[model samples]
Target: MLPHCIGVYACGMGGAGMALATDATKIASNPALGGRLGNELSVSLGWMHPDRTMDAQGPTPPGFPFPFANTASGEQTSQIENYPDGALAFNYRLSPTLAVGAAMVPGGGGETKYAMSRTATGQMGFGNAGAMYDSQVRIRYASLTPTVAWTPSAKASYGASVILGYMDFKSNMAVMNPAFTGLPSSPTLMTSGANELERVYGIGLKVGGVWDLSPQVSVAATASTGTRYQRLDDYRDLFTGPLHLPPNFGVGVTFRASPSTDIVADVQYQMWEAVEAIGGEQPAQGGFGWENQPIFALGVQHRLSDRFAVRAGWNYGPSPIPDDVVFANALFPAVIEHHFTAGATYAISDRWEVSGSAYFAPKVTQTDPGTGDMFSQFGGGTVITMKQYGGQVGLRWKF
Candidate 1:
């Protein structure tokens, strides 16, 4: 699942939120912090819940033999009742500047469902079969990373980390009402599953320096680059075609505004263009390649006292899916252009802390040309629209 692989907190923090990850317990930023372990071991646990809603524009006119044209107004929407996921991580310090760690996190997946009773007329045939259908795609990956950091001097620090992991993908699609009679009782559908437990690896190098411009002020900057994932073939079933994990890089800065507050900002770019659909690779099913997108984030954190703290942040990005490629799968649908989020954290004791956060994505609209603005040729003409929201809570314990 994209949520699991990207880190549950990633939903709200974005790529730049790493500045707040000062300890080994938070998984949002660089894992090298895990190497800062003193003489004790550390562990962290996190959980997330997501809610979503979608509203779509009715299909275009011109009665044709397609799915969209079969309805009074080929438009459909839905609200997901519940969506939940989580993660866990552990780290051990072998020396003052070296640490090893392992973590289990949810990646990302897609889901969409629609139900309606209606009829329409189009060029291909009378539209009534594809009127109702439910489809979904779920993909997930778990990773383990070990890191080493060298704080050779008080002014600068550097490190390297490696990631190894496994991936799984499953897809289910069904056309609730097939047009013809005497056909299979179940809705027309296609399903596929694949599990690839391969040795995937990534290396990251980070360097940062602190300049004490004055006693009460300081400035710092860090930059890193490495492959996030080499190939996504192991989870081919999750996509309409083959895809590859692209390289990523980020640069960020932190400024101390006051004795107990700080502001952080970062801009990261992922070479999403390197990713191509599985179908695109084959000679026949011409691919609808996705374009690269840039993600921007900004956050602020305040220390309330010796053991209490709070933070808030925001992020935005362009949709990864193209408008022309509309796959009616339950796992994912309605990819949009932006996301919004907010969150906070509190310390329960000297050794434990808890945090909570939420995310919201606005609704998006699109039209399928082949389906003729409103219907599915297989069943009834079913029009679809979608949106999403998510929340998370986590616990951190430091030894």
Candidate 2:
């Protein structure tokens, strides 16, 4: 899902903490920025709500073996899903010119549970477009980074982090169609036996920098190298290949608009097209047919008093899943495109603070007319849609 979420500060800013290093999130957003903050630690928990559904193609082969058209109009939803995306970070400044930082947190993930599906299957060679089936996919990724930042001048700084990534992916789908391709010889796709897929540890690196243009303005940039994930041993018959997390780059700027207000803006690019398993043009032959995605975000923070502060932000991006690939990607739909966010921070004391944020993205629906080679044989005119909203709360200690 690449929520692009990390610590509370980053989340409150709509993923715009790279240049505004005010909290512990600096350890994850820009290692170099961390040293500027004294020793600090934070923990956060989050929740998600999604209303999604998938419908069968409008046109199907006459006498299709399944009853997809009949049940395609229903809404399938998971009103709430609570996930743990907590972070703990520490920063140390060895000298006026050198600093170090470290953090552990969730990097990316998504979950989908589809209880509403058109599964009207018949005894045949394979399940028709309309078959009774239940399916779900949940992917989780975590990362630990230790960073070092060097400041050679009062106005410029640079840093790098060693990234250690851990990821787990699971998928389950079953169709009552007697014509299931995995019927007798390869029934693993239909049940729990060999359906689970996992990728243990993947490693990578990140580097970033911030430059002071003036007393109240700064520019920042960060880049991450891609991670090559291990293949799925249990589902070798399904993927037949390996999948990888793509690299990404971002640039941002921050301005101290007033004595109590700061404004931040950012542009980011994810090189998803570099990954073959899911970055191609189609989902068949074990590909997810995904495309590269770009993100734009902005945030404004204002201090009402020494003890109270509030912030709001906007994050936007194109859907990674295209309409042509909506069918196969139904289980992994990360298509929501527009998000509005708001939050506030309360200072419990000089050394303790509480931060919270909330965001909502309107639903995005992709419809595939089904002109590809596979659609003609299987089905056509399918539709997939996803809408999401979430919130988080964090407690921080700064020394």
Candidate 3:
């Protein structure tokens, strides 16, 4: 999953600032907060780096035609990638109690590239037909959200947004046919065969609200119907079903502990099982077998003085891939579950500010439940591990 918070303010707070209107970036998180900002603009840029590796040991069945010599015992490390992330947002008050806003930000996606060694016959144990082949997959998403918010009373604000999204996807990996028997009549080993980048467009909706419970407490919630895109004709035989983004819902609360200090907490749930290509049965169905996931975030911000503030936070979630499905998920090892973040903001003037934030996720590893049955598809002595680090810098202007 991609980092949900594209702006430095929210990233510094571990993505828990959705309930409060701190900056124009709120338009992407909870549009209701836009009404609270009279006029604001924000822009940010960042990079993400992930470290991933895979190790496997294979067994040659007594009666098999090709013994997959390259899979005997080997370890492959994924190449490091510095993926870029950025966002721009603006909010304008159309009336005393009405506001319009827009934001361009990343939705969610991942990338992986693994180098493999070929055998004497120009075929690898992984079943790729090319010599010295590398298994790789990259998927990216960008979204533009236009929102309208209304505040009829001092107690609450409501908003709605329309999401226009685009996706770029490509994959070059080996896949086994369900009925493979290593016999002459069995289906031959197949791969995606260096497909070109494919593009798709989709639309979705989001609605949210923020309510003040008292002078020092407030709560907010937001939900989105994930985008549905056109079919990837080039990948018809590579995947079980068309790929679609997953839906999500989140809630957050903010409390003022002191005049210069505030604390925030949030919970978000992703419905991966609702997507056909992501939550399908197994390898036979060409799905990832990913389970629904829930994430938690907590943050604290303290104003050191009139011109400076500091923030720190923590975020956590359980891995969505079950142990039984580890074999199939090797191509996408999104196993990191813990994140630690810190950041600071400096007000250069009454109407200008600069903010920066950084975060790191510790390494996590998972091993497959190897049963020596390759045809079962799930059993293989494969281990996958991943870790991540990233940071962002931004400038915000208020008019």
Q: Write the per-residue lDDT of candidate 3 for residues 116-144, one digit (tens) a residue.
A: 53121113423443444335678888889
Cα lDDT tens digits for candidate 1, 351-396: 7767666666666654333332122222222223455566667776
Each model's lDDT = 0.45, 0.71, 0.77
Q: Give the TM-scores of the predictions, in the order they appear.
A: 0.67, 0.87, 0.92
Better of 2 and 3 by lDDT: 3
Which residue pairs of candidate 3 clash? none
Best by TM-score, which number?
A: 3
- Arranged by TM-score with the best first, the candidates are 3, 2, 1
Give candidate 2 regions above 4 Å deviation.
61-75, 78-80, 116-134, 173-193, 197-199, 373-379
**Tens-digit lDDT string for candidate 2 (271-388):** 8878876776455555667789999988899999999999888888999877776666766778889888888999999999999988888989887667654532243566778887
Q: Which candidate order results from sorting by lDDT in descending order?
A: 3, 2, 1
lDDT of 3 at 68: 35
Query: lDDT: which candidate is best?
Result: 3
Angstrom error at residue 398, model 2? 1.6
Candidate 3 overall Cα lDDT vs. reference?
0.77
